[model samples]
Target: MAANDFYKTPSDAVTAVNSIYFLLNAGSNAVQTPYNTLFNTGMNFMGDDENPGPGATNPDVRSQSVLGHASTGLRVLQIWQQHYSGIKKANIAIEKIPGIDFGANTKLRERLIGEAKFLRALYYFNLVRLYGGVPLILKDLSTLEEAHSKPRRNTVQEVYAQIEKDLIEASTVLDPIAGGADAGRATAGAAKALLAKVYLTQRKWENAILKANEVITGPYGYNLVQNYAEVFLPIYKNGPEHIFSAQFKSVSQGQGNNQAPRSVLTGVPGIVGSYADQVVFYSVPDATKPGGVDKFFSVYKLYSKKDKRRDVTFVTKFKSPTNGNWYGRLNDPAIPGDSVPFFNKYWDPANVSNLAESGANVPIIRFSEVLLILAEAENELNGPTGIAYTNINKVRRRAGLDDLTEGLSQHQFRDSLYLERRLEFVFEYQRWFDLIRERDAAGNGILESSLHKVGKTNASAKHYLFPIPQQEIDLNPNLEQNPGWL
Candidate 1:
């Protein structure tokens, strides 16, 4: 622990662990900084799917996204620092809680430790996936001397091993779910689901399948909500589909943040009657907006007319009161040719708060993802078996799509599974990581053909791993940069 007297009782231990979840949503400065939104902005823009929205004031974010590479950019640096800050908090709780004995029943103490370990693993998981192997700091630096002794980066494999160990231990000690005030805390099911994803990222198909099955069959009471659109509604948050989400409250800007800037329709500068504040978070757009600077690619063109998810996923049509005309993201008589679509997934019409402060929980993992994992892992193990087909069909049926073709080869199933994930998780900050993990058959480059298809020609072998932030390198002379950045 950072201080020996920091955690003396079980309540103190629980409070410290709870603080980690708060850091995930609200930043150190609270109102001005929403850590999760900023982190997702960096991830979403870096990918090929989203573009910088019109009138975007953040030059650092815009340059990093459109140019496809910026080692020392502001958002990149902030993301690195925020993640490490989270890791530091998690480390403190993990190190201190286990040693303190709480009278008779040790279950409370042990569960708190499990929660800390789960959060620590999650912080490390994000670090490994983004910057590859980062410094694996598991304990708190209690003094300035300990902190000044800079640590070197560990191997990617070593980081994964640590993450795996933490999650495995967490699953055993944590409860399946929490109620009342502790509703959003980590659960045994969350640990299993995350561990399953870790295995999937490592391409350990059998292990991924095993962990996913435990999550699916476990008595956590998770299920796919009937309506795809309703699943993201603030009322339905942490409901049936939710395995894990970063909880937010709409009381104040300092208290909570949302995905509005990246998902809303923004344009029309300085208009008094503008509906901007009603729909979006900030006046300045961060990523994509409908009918403005950077807009979404036409996923509507790819989706069937019968597909329900298309409407839920992206905004295609809306009424524009400014011009007293109707507008459509793709093609409509009232809108101009340049207008493109924006994400509608995070829209909360009921949220009439100032600056569109939303209470909507940001989903990290859902039951649908578990089903997809089961399908993908099963198909990889054996070419489109009955189990794989059945699970994939469940997702498709909800989206108003037909069942997948029955006789796909192993390679074909892999491609189909990737496409499914793309459509399912659009605008949720999953695309970049998905592309990073995907490898070509020749193993020459990551997302080579996929990036090219999306006109992300700036993407190259060097992009397989993000450069270790320059600020971190400067602070710690021992830290080495990722290969291409060197």
Candidate 2:
């Protein structure tokens, strides 16, 4: 097993493993994570909703961008160093899991090992997916000698191969569903769900469909929540549909990190009472889409009015200010009042208990997405026409959109599904990868052969795979830069 202090003891291994969850946060304008540079950060710079923090010019933000570009800046090195530090810790826990005593309980040992492997795979997958083929170091390479001696990029196939393998192993060990206190932990369904996604990205449509279907139809203890908006309530932590969500606790100053309370950071800027320099931990008001009720209203189709999820998923302007919640547009004059959008989804008027305190969990992998993957892969396997409507309708039904009553050709169905995907799962960090897979080697889809002209779609350029941080390259000459940049 990995010989490291953090790798010693089952408890120590668990603590180290838990730390990896912190890496899952999406929207934090705090100085620590240069939110502006990351596409996932909803607001880039303006701290205002419309404008995220200024781009990479913000040192932390800039460094994050440079990690992909050819720039040999220290910020790039810092991000790389820190990321590996977390990766290394998680890797060590995975390695040591088997060696530790998980007691006579066979399931306990298997579950812990599975948990560690899932975390290890998740951390490495994030790195590999972000920065093409990285040094696939599976152990703690602590010293200068070890760091400098680490090998160059492993093939991208090999990187994904490892991810696929870990997830498969995790599926074997993780509990199917333990419930409540254990819901947030890795589950057999989570591994299967992630494996299906990886397979889809790899274009192994058959496997993706099979795995996704297994999760969708199998006994994983998940189902569609009755009310979509109520689904976001911390009170609904036990919702059957959520396969796995990053858990947070309600402290006076909320405990835990991640997208669970990210809305607070993005939606609620520092108020007169709150300090500007405040590291608003859990929740924030949306500067761009200000009111909890107003933004929810925006989701309504001007004409297609029957969508039940509209009220279920978001609190629209039509809904009256309940006991505590009120609806109003973002009042920011910088962006015209008409243009300013409020975020209605994922807020609790009951949260007036405290703006910062929250217990909301972020759905990292919900069964709904698994259902979508299953439908997508099944349709793709059948050339989109044979069973296309069946696959598309499941997600559409959930989103309050009408199903395609008549069968459409393969190409049309593909576009229909893609649009549904975008609407059903906005701001969930799935779009970028989804587009990447649908596109060709050139980073565009076959029928529509061009990446969406968005921020970082440099498929031709290796910027798609961020650089192996300048410092790491400098230290280990074996490391090679992706094609486009230095």
Write down the worst ten-residue block by lDDT for model 2: 271-280
Total clashing pairs for each candidate: 1, 24
lDDT string, candidate 2, 176-289, tens digits: 886756667888988998888888777788999889878877788677775666566778875787776656556533352323233332323221112111111112245555
Cα shift from native, residue 484, model 1 (Å): 1.1
Global lDDT of each candidate = 0.74, 0.56
lDDT of 1 by residue, 1-486 (tens): 434777887778878888887767774222223234675456666665666655344677666665445678777777777777778888888888778879887989888889888988988888899899889998888688998989999999999999999999999999998767877889999999999999999989999999999999998998988899877787777887888888877666445445553455544221111121111111223244454523324444456778888778766445444565554444333434534455766665555223246677778888999999999888877768999988888998999899999888877777788888888887666878888886554544456566665666677777777788898889998899988795
Overall local distance difference test of candidate 1: 0.74
What would the TM-scores of all predictions be? Answer: 0.88, 0.76
Error of 1 at 446 (Å): 4.6
Off by over 4 Å in 1: 27-35, 267-297, 317-339, 353-355, 441-446
Q: Model 2 reaches what TM-score against the true structure?
A: 0.76
